[model samples]
Target: MKMDGETEQLHVVLFPFMAHGHMIPTLDMARLFAARGVKTTLITTPLNAPTFTTAIQKGKNTSRPPLINIQVFRFPAQEAGLPQGCENLEQALGPGVMDQFFKASAMLKEQLEQFLDKTRPDCLMAGMIFTWATDSASKFNIPRLVFHGTCYFSLCVGEILRLHQPYKNVSSDQEPVNTFLLPSLPHQIHMTRLQLSEELWSNKETDYKKRSSKVKESELESFGVIVNSFYELEPDYADFFKKDLGRRAWHIGPVSLYNRSNQEKAQRGKTSSIDQHECLKWLNSKKPDSVIYICFGSTIHLIPSQIHQVLMALEATGQEFIWVVRNEDDLGGFEQKMTGKGLIIRGWAPQMLILEHEAIGAFVTHCGWNSTLEGIAAGLPMVTWPMFAEQFYNEKLVTDILKIGIPVGAKKWTTVPSIEDVIKQNAIEKALREIMEGDAAEERRCRSKEFKNMAWKALEEGGSSYSDLSALIHELRGLSTKNHN
Candidate 1:
């Protein structure tokens, strides 16, 4: 399908899950398409559109104005039994509203299909949760590509574990301390059953499993999977996803680094609600690689007890720290308790900017995929305190595979209450020390640096990730050409 020396227009629609972690990376992917002269449209709800404004403005500021359109649709909040504006996962903070959020999300299907019919996009690229988009794309004879915001390592491990259920044989009582070895990995990977999410270990039926099954089915029916990972960073795992899954897959990321707004400006207007300058100034006062930056990505809700324990641990370390306080109630005047010791951002913080700062010695993270990739890009070792979802799997990658982190010894999943293992101040202190100043910290730091180099190289021209992006764009253009003829 030659273009006769003329560039044929290819329009791609990006429909990401409402979570910020999902939105940010998918937006970056859209920017990549725009950078290559592909027309892109990001379909989002009215409430979520504002979040993309700063990044969109940043794209326009650059010489080549990204042909990225912002298509906002009305959310069915009332129908879903949610408040008028509660369209996103972050806004629905309580567990009760999760079903409502999904209900609203499902309602978008009709509008999205109508939008697709009107616009006739060359392809639809959507988050894993939007499983219905595959069928929508099929109606138009268009390809629907599933975008997974995590790395190839976590994805492979998750798929393998799901199929084999190796942990199934491990007794429930023994899971608290016992380790289960995964059978068919290039490297030996072992984890306690407790390390997995509670739902995975449950014997009864769950809505989670039902939802996950749909996502899995959607992936099997989709054109391919677009993952936010780099080839050099996980060569073996990347190969595993491509070969074993028998699916077209592209490892074209750490996509956050590609957008200037995300990497350089802290995304200005669209970033944290708190002040960025104050935090950066405080970071300037600290020594190189001496500050620990702590943040849990948007979805994780920490109990007050856990928050207190984290505060005590940070204070005990006596190290300079920066913490993102999501819930004001959780702080309980801890800011005054540690006045000169650390800085606290009241709301969201510019995570990428903070991670990239030279003063960041270690990260205390929830092990979210976005945070994990950002930490790797920054070359900082971590203190992994996984809360929920694929975070525990990501923790395994960081602690076992990458060898760039120390676990905070959270024995049970935070989302469910099968058994609560309070991560004590002493355990937190020890994990912080191991990542910051322990004997193996140097090795971890060196490994982090190596990954950082590879991450950058993967994005460079002629690199693996770079080639994957190019191939994807070419394939999409060919699809459009074929559809037209």
Candidate 2:
């Protein structure tokens, strides 16, 4: 339905949690809304203010400039119980981090009161961590929209499906919950006990039975939720989010689609971000679509044990690849560990550029939300190597539901883990080779292109995402203009 309003002018606020993954995408969304003439106030901690600004700098469409104003609100540290300079949600490291997040929420309420007192934003869109938003929004008589910085499939598993319900705080030493059922999800999408953790399951300090139980309550109550995916990508999941959850869901991604397009135009035929590897040149040197791209995302830590296993697997397989690894210090024992016919870049790679390169055939990813979307947007197939909490869920959607990626659900962060599913090294190599060079590769390419087109249409004028955003702007204007009489 079209939103009934005089003009689509809105005085909106954007508040994302202070992390690269969370803040960057929210900033892009803010830019999109601002471009559409929404008066956008983006709220962030001091640390992230610069991060968002840098992203805007990259969006180089000066002719059609960003159409919104960004406002920053700072919450006190000790009061919010966060150590000063906490850039991203530390609580994300493990379940032990939840208490800190809870404390941060209490702190935000105090700081937010001062913020609202000075400037009344029409409505608030917050990162999901600030679960106390309903209380604050109600106090100010404004709607609060919580943005889940992940795939809808992951959120559904987190929200409606309760996929982790059965293993509430079970001992890890015991057999894990591999291949569990979800309430609303298709059987093709399955999860294992390896993904479940005690922190997500148990509320150690609170009276609540589990941490996820509290998470569930919050999921039920938000005024609206925004996910960085489109309906065409996962129609069944999208439908489940709306019809079953009784809430509004807008699939406005892959967000990188709009961002990559904007940045490519801005850079104007120049290389951007990290240095371009000869990997592209090398891949071009080989036959069509012959290289594998492997990356574990920004926040993952690689201890020596983990590195050794990967080295052995590659050395045994004898396949060529391109790998990106970011670590705290220099390769501690790396020379002895990885002896394979492959190139390893020690830091960040110009991911958008590399993915767009024709030589790159398959992505071996951690399945972090951003990486997953980028892989899709660039039309590359994936070899899923999920690392943390919701990534297992995301892996299932990509490999199982979407059928564009392969799920290699090995949770062993290192090759030397005592317990593993024991898929042979040859099997792993064969899988990689098959996906990159065989009929499987072609099928994946077709599906990847299919979703990419859907994402493009959703962002263009008159598409579902475009219409949803316009409606949001229209509603915001009505709220901004009308007195609540």
* Model 1 worst lDDT run, 10 consecutive residues: 261-270
Tell me the whole-model lDDT of each prediction, alpha carbons only. Answer: 0.83, 0.66
Which stretches of model 1 miss by more than 4 angstroms? 1-8, 175-178, 261-264, 268-270, 416-419
Kindly report which residue pairs in candidate 2 clash with one another.
Answer: 95-199, 177-192, 177-193, 178-192, 178-193, 306-414
Cα lDDT of candidate 1 equals: 0.83
lDDT of 1 at 295: 86
